[model samples]
Target: MRIVVAHNRYREAQPSGENTIVDAEMAQLTAAGVEVLPFIRSSDEIPTMPTTAKALLPISPIYAPRAQQELSRLLTEHRPDVLHLHNPYPLLSPWVVRTAHRHGVPVVQTVHNYRQVCSSGLYFRDGMICQDCRGRALGVPAIVHRCYRGSRAQSALMATTLAVHRGTWKSVDRFIALTTAVADHLRDYGIPDERIVVKPNAVPDPGPPAPLGDGFLFMGRLTPEKGLDLLLEAWRRHPVGALGPLRVAGDGELRPMVEAAAAERPDVSYLGQLDRAGVRAAIEASAVVLATSTWHDVLPTVIIEALASGRPVLGTALGGIPYLVGAGTPREPAGTGPASVASAVRGDGAATLPVGVVAGEAGWVVSPDPAALAAALPVARTGAAALAPAARARYERTFHPDVVTKQLIDIYADAARTAPRH
Candidate 1:
């Protein structure tokens, strides 16, 4: 089957998980001999014109017109069976959806983040979750707070896109949510429940678990929402002997802070930036993967990569992480009820500790607190080795490219078959 994938890349230098997922899916399809075409755009392509021109640009949404015209020509020429979308926010607005509808192609969009409702796209402001716009008319509180572009005008443009297109629900044929929690969030934003489908991002299997070293690892952008500050605080709270060295991967605005912390604390090591292979190597070598983000993150690919590498995760109990981690464990007995006093105590021969168990099985979940993190550090360090087999098994079964590729293809075929026939 022929398919066309469209995505507008993020402006940040760091590659996003959504980009990775799209690339992986395309590769999988091509490997299987399917005709896969990519219609790509980047935020960098947007000319850095004067403030006045830039401000007015959002009105006609020039990016949308250009993308729609380009896509129309492509669709008319190739006539792909399906048009799959990842991100079309600022650079390629709802105009792409309109183009697909006009050409009689099924449009399947993946909700990578909360950008559809929030101008910031993170549901975050002032280093915390801000849902002022959720379940309400598009709010400019984020703009007033200088959420996007740090300018009221630009933020308003972003807010306006959501406000104007709020009623364009019929344009999209299906919405691919990365998690059930993400689907629920979209449903709250008035997206029809029947149109939303849950499809978690998957990663390639990294073979068997390798021998892990003693250091803990941090992978992801060095940003406020990533909870790097909290990670630093937790490290400080731990006694010197109890804390292993921390190796941070990836770069962002918080690079200076990370550099300063690394300089001040001998245990913290900043690895700057690394490519995909480098990231996989780091995950394979580390004891535990640290996902201490303060904001609600929809299923992060790093977590899946870590698990695939047979590395355990110490993530904050927020959003869909608990659910993702739950896939690794065996079901608890039906009548096991709540934990008893004996089960709660660590030394009472209990098969599992309730505090760390997620979905009655997977890796540990600590409160988004420094003290809790400090306490859990030892447990993570100690259990990291033992957890390898189960983690690897989970990756082979769920995230292996062959397994995930088929699921993605099935979705594409279904959308293609059900697309409106012109």
Candidate 2:
């Protein structure tokens, strides 16, 4: 039951669902009587790193010798049964996987995004979904486009890191995919079907559904990829009218746009980024949650959090979203059927499907187009109250922390069995 939980925290400037998931899982495991040995690195520390350490950041992704040495020491000291890795970019490298394996500790990594194939890890570019580097041996598209942080050098470095350590990723005893789509993406990258497991991230339940408050809730990083613009356009086309105001939480590159829209329209209010409790309160108060991301998001936790709070989501039918919102059933492993083949041929870009409006529960799934989003907005206004119970039901059945934690325990046990006997 003892494990080393390793993760590299993303920069604190932007809210990170991956970071949220890691913290929640660690807390849940400890509460469940499992011992967690944390091995963590923070992007916040990068700016404060000494001059020599700053120089080391470039090689950190490729192979951080010091990180490997420290991890080796941790393995020798703790003798953990399993090493569970979340994000291993910039600070901790794939060397940790090799280090864990060398020390007889099985490694279990969570595939949080499309980082294995796309340099930005977002599978996005130029305000649109892009997947030009998939299955490519060299990842030249990322280099050509400067996808990561808009720096060719950084993007090239990430691409090189992926190329150099493709085998190191395969060395993992298990890959925890956040959704069926994520598992399918991993398989598309040549990971074996048996090695990948579908495990969606779950949030701590926010008790019972609060009384329905007002219009809708759109929360998360307010970036282009999040499709905030699309949401605004949809709102412009179809004003909130009788339902109530549309509340937007979080800040990013699109703050001015949000602020301008809020000023121009009384129905749209931009509430700056809210903390965890704030987000929950908003979810509880809102009639529906909005997830308008244009990219193939692995599994936006906001959708699940809303469902957990008994608020249905009106989200894009992209990536793992349709599955997350219960608009569609879980996809089978890749290549299992004709649909799988079609999905593969479609690449990793966000494919807009027809509007799905579920009755009584769940929510609507629409294309990112403003017209499509405009068409689905009323579904939330009309059906969200009735769908509250079903939203909570979905959370309990699939994303309850108790349920997901047990699954984690089983995965850890399976991974531990793969480790060499002491």
Q: Give the top-scoring candidate (lDDT).
A: 2
TM-score of each: 0.89, 0.92
Residue clash pairs of candidate 1 = none
lDDT of 2 by residue, 161-277 (tens): 999998888778899998888988988988888888898988998887888777999999988999998888878876446558899999899999999999998898888989987
Question: Candidate 1: lDDT of 34?
Answer: 84
lDDT of 1 by residue, 39-130 (tens): 98777756775575456456643246666788999999999888888888666677787787788888888888887788888888997889
Instruction: Kindly provide the TM-score of model 2 when superposed on the true structure, using C-alpha atoms.
Output: 0.92
Q: What local distance difference test score does each model get? A: 0.74, 0.83
Q: Candidate 2: minimum summed lDDT over ten consecutive residues — where?
A: 338-347
**At residue 143, what lDDT does model 2 achieve?**
94
Error of 2 at 319 (Å): 1.1
Q: List the residue pairs that clash in candidate 2.
A: none
For model 1, how many clashes?
0
